[model samples]
Target: KLDDADLKKGLERSISTDIQFLIAGQNSDGGWGWWRGSESENWLTAYALLGLHEAREAGYAVPEDRLARATRFLERWLTRTAELQDNATLDTRAFILYALSESGNGDESRAVELFDRHTLLDTDGRAFLLMALDNAGEGQRPRVQTLASELTARAILSATGAHWEEQAPDLRAFDSSRRSTALVLRALVRVQPEHMLLPQSVRWLMIAREIGHWETTQETAWAILALTDYMRASGELKADFSYEVALNDKVVLSEKATADNLSDPVMLKVGIAELLLEEANELIITRVTPSEGQSGMGRLYYSAWLRYYLPVETLKARAQGISVARRYEAVDAATLESLGAAVSTAQVGDVVRVHLTVNAPNDLFYFTLEDPIPAGFEVMDPTLLTTSHAAEAPGRERLDPDDSPFWYDSWTQSVIRDEKVALFSDTLPRGTYEYSYLLRATVPGDYNVLPTFAYEHYYPEVYGRSEGSRFTITPTAATE
Candidate 1:
C-alpha cells in the first residue's frame, strides 16, 4: 500500500490542504488562533505544527517559514509570563512536546519539565502527550514515563461509571461517544503501546456511534487516528478492518466490519489502515472542477469531496459556496399603559439594557441601524436580547429589568452593526455611537416612546430580530 503512487498523491494533496488552511489563520505574533482576532491558543498552534510536520513527511509542500513561525509561536509563549506562563497548567505544553518530538528536535527540556509536572488533563492534550513520551521512550523524562503510564491506566480502565477519586478510574465511561472513547484510547495506547482496549474502544465507536466531540469533525478523525496507530504498533495491519469511513461529508465508512481473529487484533488493524489511507486519498481526488473564484479552502474541499461522494443528482442540486446575508426585523404593538408612561428623551447617566419587542421567526437575523451612540454605552448582553418567547415562534412575556432598553451612557458617533445571530459571536464594532431608535420614537408627540419596536428590516423575514439588541454609553455620565 505504501508503494502506491496514486495513494501518495491523494494523501499529499489532502494533508497539504489541511495544513495550509491552518497556517492561513496564523497571527502576526507567530501563534495560531481560532476564529477571527481572538487570543492565541497554544495547543491548537502546536497541533497545526504537528499536522504540518506530518504532511511534509508525507510529501506535502508546506512552506518553511510557516513551520518555523508555528514552532516559534509556542516557544514565544513558553518563555513568556502570562496566563500561559505555567507550563504545568496549560495543555499547550503537551502539544508543544508532541510537535517537538515529531520534529525530531533534541533536548526538549522545557517540554519534558511540563509533562513531569503532570499538567495534562484526561483530554486530547493528555493523550497526545503520553503518545509523544512513548515515542520518545527511554529518552523521555523518567517522571513522564511514570506519570503517563498512570494516566493511561486511568483513561482506559473500565468502571461502573465516571469515578474521579479512584485509582485506575475511567473518566468517561458514562460518555458513550466515539470521540471521548477515542481520546481515552489515545492516552491508553501511549502508556501501553499494545495494550488491549478493543472491548471498550470498539464499544465507544460502534455502540454509542458518537464521533463528534460535542460538535466538531476532530473527534472522528482523532479516534480513527488512534485506532490506526494502535493497529500498526500491535502488528494488526494485514486484515480488512471494518467501520464507517466517510470520504467527505456525504460519505461515511459504514462498511461491514470484517470478522476479526477473536484472539488477534490483526484484522481490525489492517482494515483501519486501508480506511485511513483511503480517507486521505479521497479528499484530494476531485470530480468537479471548481471555478477559480471560489473562496475558503475547506469550502472548496467540501465541494470537491461531495462531487465524488454524493449522487450525481444531488451534486447538481447543491448550491455553490455562496452565502446570503439574511435579517429579521421586529415591531411591537402599543398597549395603553405602555404608551401612557413615556420616556421623552433617553439620557446618558445610567446602566441600561434595551428590550424592544419584535415579531421574528426561529432563525438568526442581523439588525442594521442608521444611528449612532454616546460613549461608555455598550450592550451589556447582546446574546439574550429576545425574550424566551423568542423560541416559541411567536409568544409574549415580560423581560427582566436587565433586558429593558435604556441609555447607560452618552454616545458620540459611529457606525454600529449589531449581529443578532443566535450563536452570540460577540462580534460588534467596539466603538461609541449616538443611538437614534426608530422604535418608540415612531410617535410624534414629544417622543411618545413607542411600546414596542418599529419595523425597518433589511430582509422581510426578520421578526423578533431584536433577540440581540444594541446600546451605548459614555464613561462620563450626567451624574459625573
Candidate 2:
C-alpha cells in the first residue's frame, strides 16, 4: 500500500540519480555521445539538455554551468550547420530548436528562419519544428498553423485509431516510427487539443504498445509524454468502473476500479493444463454497468499473453526482419591462409575462422550476435598477449581492404567468452554485413557447435539463427 508521497519521493530520487549520471558523462566539449568515451554528437547534446531542463522544471537541482555549456554547444552546432545548408541535418536542427525553446533560450526568429529554409521535413522533424514554434510563443502564427494543419492532414486514420508514419530514416539509433508518431501526437495535443484526430491518435499509440511498453526507450519516453499531455487535456484520469473476465463461458475474475486505484493493474494467471480446450479457447472481458443511479466512467485496458515453449530443433531459422547465416573455415595458423570451408576435422592447434553473415532489410538498433563454439575449441582472445598458433596479435592478420570478406563496421563492441563470441552494435543499417572471429582447436574430441543467433536487443521479434554443426578436433601428430 504505497501512498502518493512515497511515489513522489521515489521518482525524485530516480531523477536525481539520472541527473548525476548525465553530468558525469558530459564530454569535455559540453556534449554527449552514444556512450561514454565516444565522440560527442549535436543531437545527443540537445537530448541531454532537454532532460536537464525537464528536471529543472520539476524542481530538481541542475547545475547552471552544465546547462549553459550544453546550450552553447547546440547553438554553435545550429549556426555551423545552417551555414552548410545540409538538408540531412534538418531533423537535428528542429530537435535542437525544440530543446532550446523548452529551456527558455529559443529565438522565435531563428526558428522561423529554419522553418523557411527547410520546407520539406520528415514527420518527426515537422513535429519538432511545430513544438519549437509553440514553445517560442508563435503557436498562433499563420505559418505555424499551416504546418500544424499539414501534419493533421497527413494523419492515417482507421476505424479504431489514427497514427502518422515516418518516411525518412531515423536520425539516431534509438529513433523509431513509434517515437515519430508520439512526437506528432505531442505537437497536436499542444497546438490543437480539441482536434477530432487527437483522441484517435492517442488510441493508436496505446494500441501499438507491446504489452505495457513501447519498442524502444526513446519511443516509450515520447509516448509517455504525449499520453500525459493528452490525459490532462482530455480529463481522462479518473476511473469508476466494474469489469469481469470470462474464460470459455466461465467467470474467471471480476473487479471494480475507482479513482483511488486507477493505476493498479488487474492480473489473472491460469496454467496450460487448466485450459478448457486445446484449441479455439475463448477469453472475453465485459464492462459491467453500475447498479442503481451510480454511473461508470473512464476505460479499462487489458492484455493477454500466451506462454509456451517448443523443442530447440523444431525452431527454424527465421528472417522476419533480420537474417543471419554462419560458416566455418579452417585457416593456416602461420600464414593466415584459408585452408577450406565447413571444415569438420582439424588437428590440435588449427585455427578456425567463424564467419557470420547478417542481412537486415531495414535499419535496426541495439543489435547483438552470439555464436557459441564447440567445447573442444578455445576462442582466440584478441585482447590477450599470447603466442598460440591461433592467438594472432591484433592487427597482425591483415587482408587487402578490397578483398576482405569481413565487415568491420557491423559491430562496435565484442566479447570473447569461454564458449562463445558475442558482438554488439548500437545501430545496424540496412545491408548485408559479415563478421568473423578466430578459434583454436584444443581438446581432441567430437563436439557440437550451438547455433549462431542474432537479434535486435530491444525488439526480439526480429531475429535469426544458423544451424548447428559438429566438429572434430584431433590430437597433434607429436602428441599421438
Candidate 3:
C-alpha cells in the first residue's frame, strides 16, 4: 500500500498479522530460509530481515534480539564466504548487498565493492542488483542510475510494453517473464521515474489479468508495491473530483471533494466510511471543466480498486531450498566375483553396487543422501561411506583438510524396515562426499530402479535426485 492510502484499521491489522507470521518463521540460527522449516539461506534471511525492518519502522513491535541475531548471521556469512573467495553467483552477491544495505549496517560499502565487479545477465539478477545498489547508499546512486539505463535499454518492447526473455531465446515463459518485467519496472521507476517506458510498462501491467493478485507471493507483492508507488507519484489518485458510490445500480452515497479545503492529500479513506459495503460495489467520479463555448463539459473516467483479506487460518507458509547431489551406479566387481558370477551381466544372486555422490557447493549441516534399495534386491553386506578428497572445479580453491580441521566424515545407516539406505554427515564442507553400497539380486526380473534423493539433513529439503538406472536380472540356468 501507500502512506497516503491510510489503509483502514482492518487492513492494517491484517498486515500486522502477516508480519508476525513472518517474524515467527525465523530460524533458530537467526536466519530465514525460503520456506518454513527450511534451513537458513542468505537471500531468504535477507528478505525476512528487510520485512521485519519495515514493520519495525511502521510502529509495529519487533523483537530487538531477532534483528540482532540475523545481523550477526549475515555478517558472519559475508566474512566466511569472502575468506573462501568462492565463485559466488550474481544473485547471491546482489542479495547480500541488499541485506546489508537494508539492515542499516556499515558493511554495505563492502557489499557494493563485491557487486560492482560483476555484470549480471539474467533479468532477476539485474533487477535485484539495481535494488541492492539503490539501497547500498546515496554514494551509489550514480551507479544505480547508470545500471537502470542499461537495463531499460535491453528490455524488449512488445504490444503490451516491455518484457524479458527467460534467457536468450525463450520468451514464452511468461510467469518468470512477467516477474522480471515487474522487477525491472520497479527498479527503473525508482531511478528514472520520468522515463518514456513508464507508461507502456504501467499500461501493460494494468491490463494484465489479476495483475495485482499474482499466484506467486513474490510476484504479487512486487507488483502491488510497484504499481501503488507509481500511481501515487503520478497524481492519478486525486480526490478533487466529485465521487459517488453505488451497489447493484443502487446509489449509496455521493460527495463532492473540495481539494483546497482538505488538509490531507489525494488519499481517500473510502473503505472506512460508514456506507454499508456489499460483496461488490461500484464507484463513479466525474470532473467538469469550462469550455470556450461557455458550456461545461464533463469527462468521466471510472477506476475501481478492491481489497481482499484472507483469514489468518487460511494462510500456510512453506519453506523451500535447492538440493545438489549426483548418483553413480555400477556393479561391484569384487562383490560379484566373490559369488563366482560373471562381471559384465547382472544375474540372480549377483551383487549390485551404487555410488551416490553429493556435491555440496555451499555449507551444509547434517547433509543427507537417501537411496532406496531396489525391489527384488537385498543388502548383502554393510554399507561403505568415505571421504577422500573434495572434487576440484575450475575456479574453486578446495580447502585442505590439513589446513582446516573442520572436515566431514561420511557415515551410512540402513533401515531394514523401510528398505531405505541413507548416508549422512554432521557437517559437510563445500566439496564432495561419496556413499557406496552393495545389494544382491534375489529375483530374476527387469525393474525400474527408483531415483535416489539427497538433501540437507537438518531441514531435510531435497536438493538433487539421481538419474535412475534399469537392470534386468536373468534366472540362473538349470544345471546340466
Candidate 4:
C-alpha cells in the first residue's frame, strides 16, 4: 500500500529524530562518551562522528555546527596523542584517521606518515587505514595496494568462505572475528573488487550471522556496510525468482520475487496442531528454476524459528556458559547472628537475607541477574528507615554497626523492584561472585519464591537459573 515517497518520508523522520538525540547527548567539549553525562572518550567520539558523516552523505540534513565541533575534538585528540607520545593502539589511530578523512578534515600526507610509523598492525588497523586512504582519493597509490595485499594474504580461507580474526586483548569485549572480517571485507571491496577472495569473504559474513543479524551492534553495522558495498560493486541487486515451501511433502506456500520486493521478507506461520505428527516431519524449501533459455541470479536467505513454552517447574537448571544459584537464610535482627540456611518459617519481625552466587567459565558482556522475591516478604531499601516495630525491637541497633546493609562484589548497578531484585554488569570476567540483600518478613502467610535467573544481555543462549523455593511467616507475640 505504501509507495517510494511514503518510505522516503518515514526514513527522513527517523533520521531527524536520531540526529536530534545525538546532538543533545554531545558534551560541551563536542565529544561523546559511553553514555550521557560520563567523561568523554576518544574511540566513542570518533564512532559518533563517523555515523554523522554517513548520515550527511545519505542526503540527511545534519547541523553543520555540530559536525564542525566534533571534528575539532577528534583533531585535538590526534594531536595530543602525538605530542605526549602515548602508546595508542594502531587500530584506534587508524579509525580516527578514517573518520576525519570521510568528513573532509584530514591531511592525507600526514595520515600516510603516521601509518608508516607503525611497523606492526592488526587486522582492524590495516582495514581502517586502507579505507582512510580511499576516502582521501589515494586508493590507487602503491602504499594502499601494499596494505590491501597484506590483508588478503593473511585471510583465513575455507570451503565455506573467508574471514579475518581479531587477537587484541583490549578489544575482546567490544570486537570479534565477525567484526574484523566485515571491516576487512569492506576495505577489499573498495580497493580491489576483483580480488579472488572477495566472494568467499562475502559468503563468510553472510553465513556468520547468529540468526537475522550478527552478534553485536558493531558487528552488524560493519557487516551491513560490507555487504552493501559488495552489492553495488557487483551489480547484484536485481532478482527474478520463485520459491516454494513444503511441509510433509505438501506445498504450504509459494511466492514470486522481483527486484522491487527482493529486500522484503516472506513469512509463513503454521500452527503446531496442524503440522504435528507422531513421526518426524520435514519442511523443505526449493527455488524454482526459470523456463528454458531463462536465467536467474542473486542469493536467497531464509531462517526458520520454532516457538514453544513449558511450565516453570518442568524447566530444569541449565548452564551453557554461566551458572547461578540462590539461597536464603534467616537472621536475628538484634544480635546479627546467622539462624541457619533453612528459611521455611520466620517470625513476622525477623530479617532474612537472600544470597546469589554466579559462576562464569569465560568472559561475558552485558550480564544481568533477576531474583524474584516472595510476596510475604518486603525487600529492605537501605536508603529508607526500618519499620517502627523493628526499630524498637531489642538488639536492633547492633544490626548494622557501619550502616552498610548490602554486600556485592561485582555489579555496576542494582535495582529493587516491587517483586524482584535485579543486578547488572557491563562485563563479567571468569570467576565466582556472591551478592546478598536483606528482606523483612512483614506479612504472615505462606508464599512461593520464583526462580533466580541470569543471562548475557546480547547472547541469551548463555544463561542459567536456580530452582524456586517457598517460605512461611508466623505472627509475632504482640499480634498473636
Candidate 5:
C-alpha cells in the first residue's frame, strides 16, 4: 500500500484492474459470491464490499450506483432472514456490520443484536466481533476494550510461549491457528494499544517465527497487516535508534530515529525515487537498537516489504507468461450432449468429471495441480486420469510419467483428509496442456468442492486456483 500522496500516481493502474475484476464478477442481484461460479452469500458480499471501500478510499473511481445496489441486497437479505427466524451466522453478521459501517450504508443496531444473540465464545468469532464494533464507530470503546481483554485471558502459554488457538475443532483448526492469533492481535492493537496483552502477543509472534509465512492467502495477508499496524502503533522509542534501507545488500538510505521524529510514526516514509528496482531483487529495511548493558549484542528489528515497479515493458512481459483454467462438468456417456460447466445434482453411484488446462510460456522445471474430492464423493479409478501436452517449441519434451505424482503427498495430510486426485510434471516443456479425472458420489447430501491449486516449483510464489464448485447428492434416483 502506498501513501496518500502517491495513490493515484503509484498504484492506480493495479487498483483499477482489481476494482474492475470485482465489479464484473458481481452477481446480478448486487451481491458477490464467496467464489467464482457460486451463488451470492452474505459474508462474501460483505468482504467484497470491504475491499471495494478500501480501494475507493485510496481514490479509485468506483461506481456509486453499484455500492447502492449492493447495500440494498444486504438489507433485503438480512430483513427476510430475520423475519423467517433464520439467524445469520456470527461470521456473516460481523462482516456485514464492518462493511456497512465502513461504507457509510447502515447503522450498527442489527449487527449488535445478532452478536448479542449468540454466545459461541470461539476465538475467530470473538475477534471478528471486536473488529466489527470498532469499525462501526458506535462509541463502544469500553466494550471493545473488554472483549480484547477477555480474549487475552483465554490465551494459553506452552513451553514455547503464549499464543491463541483456532478453537475450531474441525478440519480448519490446524490451518487457522496462526490466522486466529493474527486476528486477535489486530483487535487488541486496535482497541487498547497500552494493554499488557499487546506486548505479550507481539513477543509471542516474534518468538514463533515458523508460523510467519502461512500457505493460504488470507492468513498471510492478515499476518502482514497485523504486524505492520502493531509496529506503527508501538509508541515512542525508549532507546536510541538508527534506520537503514538497502537494495541488493547496497545501502541506499540511512537516518536516525530520535525522540523528535519517532514520537509520531505517521510522518515516516522512505522514498525510493532514485533506485531502479527490477523483478526478483531483494530490498531490506533494518532498525538497530543500541544495547545499554555492559556485555550484550544489540537488538535488531528487521521488517522488509517486496518492492516491485511495473513500467510498460515489464507489464507487457507479464501478460505473456502463464495462464491456467479449471472447470467442473456433468457428462453423459451415451448422448455426449453438453450437460453444463456446473454440476447441480447427482444421485448415488453417479460419476462426476473435472477438466483442467494450462499454458506455459517457458519450459517448467516442476508443475503440480491438486483438487480435493468432496467427502461424499470418491475418486473413481484415480489411476485412470489422462494428460495431453502440445509443445510450442521444437525439442521441448514433456515430463517423464515416473517423476509425476497422481495424488496428494502426505505433506498436507494433517490439514485435509479428503482423498484427492493430483497431477505433477517435471521438465514440462513450453506448451498448452489438458487433463481430466472422475469421481463417484456415494453419500447423500450437499457438498462444496474445495478450490483446486496449481503450483510452480521454481517460482513458488506464483500460483493459481480453480473457481470453487458445489453439487447436491440425492439418496435415490427418484429424489433427483
Candidate 6:
C-alpha cells in the first residue's frame, strides 16, 4: 500500500519539475512551442496542457498558475483561430474543443460558437471532438454518439486494414508541417478504449523499439513509460519485444547530450516526464535533433546510472532472489496458448504473472478466455531447459521417460547425450519486441524456479534477426 504513496511522491517531484519547461515553452503568440522557441505553436501548447493535466492526475504536483497560463494559451489560440476562419485545422480544432469541453466551457458562448457542425463530421476532427466530448461526459449526445460508434468500428476493423499504408489522423502534422500518421492513435485510443486494436501511439513506440532506436538510456526510459501506459490500458500484454540492445559494463547511455533532428525531435513522447528529463543535469539521450539547437529539448538524468540500474538489476536478481524486487523474463507467445515468466519452485495451483512494457502488433497478445495453465501449473521448463543431461543429480530422480512423461523434445530415437547444450532453436521474427514474464505466488511455491537463456546472438550487430536471453532455474522448496 505504501508503494503507491512512494510512487506518488516520486511522480509529484517529477510533475513539480515539468511545469517550468511547459511554462517556459510559451511563445510571444501566447501558445507553446515544440520545445522552447521558433514559434508560439498552438498544437504544442495543447499537447503540453494535456500532458501536464495527465501528470497532475497521476499525482504529480503541477502548479495551478502554470495550468492556468497553459489553459489561457489554449483559449487564446482557439479564439484567434475562430476569428481567422481557419477552423479546418483538424488537430488544433479538436484539441481546443477538447480543452473547452473538458473544462466545462462547453456551455460557454465561445465554445458553442467554436463547435462547427460542418467540419465536426470530418473524420479526424470528428474523432478528436468525440474524445473531448467523451471526457466531458457529453459523448452520449447524438453527434458524439455517432462518432463514437464510427471510431469503435474503425478500431475493430483496424486489424484487417492496410496498417502500414493506410493513413490515420496525425497530431504531429501541426509540427514540422508534415503529416505524421502516428497521432491518429492518440484520438483513437482515447475515444474507443474498449476496442481491441493496439493504440498507434503504442505502435509507433513499438516501431521505435523494433528498430533498436533505444540505444541510449534516455530512449529506453521513454519507451518503458510509453509501452507501460499502453499495455496497462489495453488490459493485455504483448508477448514479444520490439527491440533489445546489449548492455556492456559501461553506462547504458552516451556521455554527452544528444543532437536532435526534425526527423527525430529532442522530445519523442511529448509528456511531462520528457520535460522533466530535459531539465536534468545529465541527459540519457545524446543524439540531438535540429530542434535542440534552437528549442533546448534534451532531457538529462540526475543520478546518472542509478535509474538505469533499477529495472535492469531487478530483472537480474530474480533467478536467485538476490534482489527484494522481482525481475521477469521475456517470453515469445507465437503459436502458444499464453506464455509468461515464472518464479522458481512454483506449483500447479499458483498464479504466475509478469510486468512488462509491451506493444503487440494489435490485440494479438490477449485472449477472450483465460489461459489453460490454471488447473495444475506445470512448468515446461522452469529453467527453459535448453540443455539436457542423462545423469541425474544426487537428489534429482532419474528420468526413465515414465516419471517425466510431460517432457518434450526433438527425437526419441537418438539416445540423449549431453544436457550441456541447447536442443533446438526458438527463432525470433524479424521485427523488434520488448517483453517480461513472471510467475506469481498464486501459482504456488514459496520459491521461484527461474529459467536461463543459453543461446547468444549479438543484438547490436544484427538488427535484422532475433536474439534470446538465458537464465537458470533453481528450485527452492516451497516455504508454506
Top candidate on TM-score is 2
Relative to the unseen true structure, what is the Cα RMSD of model 5? 17.7
User: After aligning candidate 1 to the native by TM-score, how far in Å is the CA of 264 from where it should be?
Assistant: 21
lDDT of 1 by residue, 1-480 (tens): 355578777876777677767777788776765554556777667677777787778667878888888777777766773245342345455656677777664235665655655543445455556656766767765655665455445554444222112222232111223455576566666566655554346444543332222223455566677666666665543333333334434443233222232222211112334445443544322323333542212210011111123332222211111111112122233211122222324334332223223322222222223222222333323234542221212112322335653432311112223322111211222222122222211111121111122211222222221111222222333334
lDDT of 2 by residue, 53-73 (tens): 989987889999999999988
lDDT for each residue of candidate 6 in 264-332, tens digit (9 for 90 to 100) = 222222234433454443333333333323433323322112222223213342211111122333333
What candidate 5 gets wrong by more than 4 Å, as runs, is 1-10, 34-37, 80-88, 159-161, 169-175, 206-212, 236-299, 302-480
Give the clash count for each candidate.
40, 0, 6, 1, 0, 49
Q: Identify the candidate with maximal lDDT.
A: 2
Model 5, 278-335: lDDT tens digits are 7556677776454353222223343343355543212221222456565666767543
TM-score of each: 0.47, 0.79, 0.49, 0.75, 0.51, 0.37
What TM-score number comes out for model 1?
0.47
Q: Single out the weakest 10-residue window by summed lDDT for candidate 3.
A: 387-396
Q: What is the C-alpha lDDT profile of model 4 across 213-252, one tens digit per residue?
A: 8877878988999999988787667777778899999999
Query: Pairs clashing in candidate 2?
Result: none
Regions more than 4 Å wrong, model 6: 1-15, 25-30, 34-39, 83-90, 100-124, 152-192, 196-209, 212-234, 237-480
After superposition, candidate 3 runs with Cα above 4 Å error:
1-7, 34-37, 83-88, 166-175, 239-480
Which digits, one per residue and each the tens of the lDDT, describe model 3 over residues 1-480?
344445567667887897888878888889886456667877667778888887888888888899888888887887767634323444455666666666676465665666565464356656667777787668888778767877777778889676654353211112255566677787777777887887777766665535235544555667777776675566555434455555546655555544332334243445535445565454544343432442222222233555665542243322233333333244435433223232323678666555555556666655556677767787644332331122111111223535442323333233433477766554556665555545666777776666567766434433666555555777788411
lDDT of each: 0.42, 0.78, 0.59, 0.76, 0.61, 0.39
